[model samples]
Target: MHIALVTETYPPEVNGVAMTNQRLVRGLLAKGHRITLIKPRHQEAPPAEHASLQVHEVFGIPIPNYAGLKLGLPRPGELERLFEADKPDIVHVATEGPLGFSSLRSARKLRIPVSSTFHTNFQDYCADYGAAFAARWMMAYLRWFHNQCALTTVPDPSLIQRLEKDGVQRLQMLGRGADTVLFSPDKRDPELRRSWGATAHSPVALYVGRVAAEKDIPLTLEAWAAARKHCPELKMVVVGDGPVRKKLERQWPEVHFAGMRYDEDLARHYASADIFIFASTSETFGNVVIEAMASGLAVITYDYAAGKQFIQSESNGHLVSLADRQSFIQCTESVIQEQSKMPPIRAAARATAINYPWSATIDRFNHLLQKAAKTEQITPQIDIVSNSEQSTL
Candidate 1:
């Protein structure tokens, strides 16, 4: 299959979206499929040398205040000309951005199959930038943007339900995968654990991913504060960097910040931790939970989205109740006190992660693209102005 994967982020960026696309691209190339990877030029992007992967560099404007990265803006007619020059059977927009929108418009003009992935919640993300009121407007824009594509893929059934309720047409369940080989129990480094003030028996809790307000990071701090009452050595290791890093580190100097890690280095950090705590309420899929699970770590997360789908409370790890912070603390401490119960929990978690493989996931994406190309383009059946204000939760 000839596929053009358009995304705003790509390799060397080191986030869930980029990491996910990297794996999918590698897998697709291995399966004898060609992929034209389109993305903005980041300072850290790897060399584009793969024979099967064609890299198209787009003009990037700095994402204000953000160093080493930029965003691709809209240029519809230029993209249309590119599509006309070299056509692909499938045009997949992996991220929702100006570049993706332009790609969609171009693909539509060329009468090619079009598809997209719902990787993040920009509506919820606006709140982090102090534009909370703009969430509704953003949601309305997203609904219209995605509905134009023939197929839209998200990671969970819960999100699929939510998107359907929000009038998202032709929604598809496209699960993400983790790298089991690197993120195995064998990657655990006792030396590294000791360096972080963790004794062999002391409980070590972890939060890995981007450090942003929308990540619900403050809740992790709250949970850690509660955990410290019972176990002082209940160390918290935060392994990622973002605009909030300085503030978070200054606010809580005792916490260890490992900064951003990628590939095998990241896997080691996941394996070394005793318990994985994901307090985020806004995740679409929570791929880090699966990565931690694949690395054989006991997980404690809320009972929704990724957590509800994977964590079986008391069976694998505790799934904290949303309404009761005290109950959450109690359940968390109980698990930590009996931290001996964690090995089996971690094992079961790792066992569950093996079910999601990148090869199968990418193959499913290809199949969906092929199927959508044969179906009628998803234009609205009725013309009714959608209320942009009522979409926010």
Candidate 2:
């Protein structure tokens, strides 16, 4: 099948959405599917080259407060022209940005099957950005935009329920996977742990993600402080960079800040750590949690998204009540106190991760796209409304 994928971000972006999209594209290509990838061109990165993959770069502007990310601008009729020239069997929008809106409009104009994936909680972001009042409006817009698609794919069942409750139609659960081979306990390096001033006995707490306000880094730090009071030898390692990195570095001078390590280095960071902490409540699906678990780190996260989906609390990992900062801290202390159970918990975490493979995820995605295409063939075509004319409607 020839598939057209529209997204705002792609490879070398150092985010979950970009990485997942790249993985899906490669997986689809491996399955002999021709792909047309439409995304924003990164200034510093070279274009991706593949035999079955066709790349289309569009104009984009840097997203405010997101240092390395860019949001694609709407192209009125460009997508329509592309689709008409070499029409695809199906269209998949991996983001809900301006580019995605245009893609939906273009696909509809061409009477093509179009589906979407909900990767982020943009409405929840409004609260983090001090625009809480706009959350309802943003959610309403998202619901309307996704309802236009043949299907809307979500990463978690919890997200499907929440979006359905909010009146978002055609919701489907398309779960994520982790690279177990790349992220394993075998990747642990003694030298790396020593570099962070962590001894064989001293526990290392790891946090890997964007160092931004939306991540609730302050809550993680607070929990670390509480855990440190009991385990004095506890060392914190933050493995990412963002807008608040400078401020966080200043505030917690003792913490080891390994900014933006990818591939093997990232795997080593995850493996070398003893425990993983994820404090973000804004995530639609926390990919880092699974990555950390796959690396054999005993994860302590809130009871939702990936944590609730994958973790078997106290067995594989620990799950605190959502947004309960005090409970989050207490759970951290419990993990610290029961150090002997860490190995078993870590083993169970790795075992759980092995069940979720990329092949399975891609297979499900391909099946859904095929189903959507088949549905489009049987359904009657409707008049296409261009995105530019959406405001008037």
Candidate 3:
């Protein structure tokens, strides 16, 4: 199968969508498939080195308030030429950016099957970015984009239901997985823990993700502060960088801000922590939650998406209601107060996380692409020319 995967981001970008795309592309290549990977280029990273993979770089502009990430520009003319030369069996649109929009148009014009995956909750992000009024318009555009594809893949059932309610057709459930081998309890380093002023007996609360408004990072800090009141020795470390990292670091000088750790280093940071707090409500599926769980950290998150699917409150991990912000803080404090139950909870989390492997997710993704290629395409009613010319959100 020759699969042309189009996205605005890819590996060395340190985001969930980028990492997931890399994993899927590698998995497909391993199964003896040719891949044409098209994405926005990053100066620090080179094109993927694979015999079966062909990478095409495109021009992009930096997104507002998002540092180190680019919004890929539409290249309809270039894409049409590329498709004409070596037509792909299927084109998978990962991100609904300008580049992805152009790819969809090109593939449709060439009469090729196309599929898309709903990765981010851009509609939910509107409120965080002070553009709450645009959320409805965002959803409308999203529905129009995905409805055009033969299949629209989502990470969780909750998301599938939400999109269906919003009138998105051809929806399918496709879950993300954690790398248990790389992110295991065995990766725990006592030296690293000590650097964060944590010891064997002392607890280290960890938060790993973009330190941005949408992540509800303020809630994580508030929970950590409240938790520290009961257990004065409790330490907090935030791993990952974003637009607000500098401001947050200055605001909370006591907390350790370990910026942008990747691969094995990222796993080590996860293993060194005792508790993981992910308060973000806007997620298709929180990849970090599963990774933290795989690293044997008792997680505390909202009762939805990955948390609701894998965690049993007070068993494997903790779950708070999305509507109750106060309850999240209380839950974090209570989890810290009961130190005796930590080992069992952590053990259960790791055990459950190991069950979900990347291999299974890859197999399912491949099946969806193959199935989509055989299905008839649905012509979208929206004007592709107008949409492609519009500015990227």
- Candidate with top lDDT is 3
Q: Which one is best on TM-score?
A: 3
Colliding residue pairs in candidate 1 = none
Candidate 1 C-alpha lDDT tens digits along 257-289: 999887788888898898888887778888898
Clashing pairs in 3: none
Q: Which residue pairs does candidate 2 place in steric collision? A: none
Residues 19-66 of candidate 2: C-alpha lDDT, one tens digit per residue: 899999999999999999999877866656678889888889998767
**Per-residue accuracy of model 3 over 1-393 as CA lDDT, tens digit each:** 999999998978888999999999999999999999998878887756798999988899998777878988856599989887878999999999899999888888888899999999999999988899998778878887888899999999988888898889999898888899999999999999999898888999999988888998888999999999999999999998888999999899999999999999999999999999999999899999999999999999999999988999999999999848999999999999998999999999999998899999999999999999997766753554235324443
Clashes of each: 0, 0, 0
Model 1 spans > 4 angstroms off: 74-76, 323-326, 380-393
For model 3 the local lDDT of residue 359 reads 94
Worst 10 residues of 2 by lDDT: 377-386
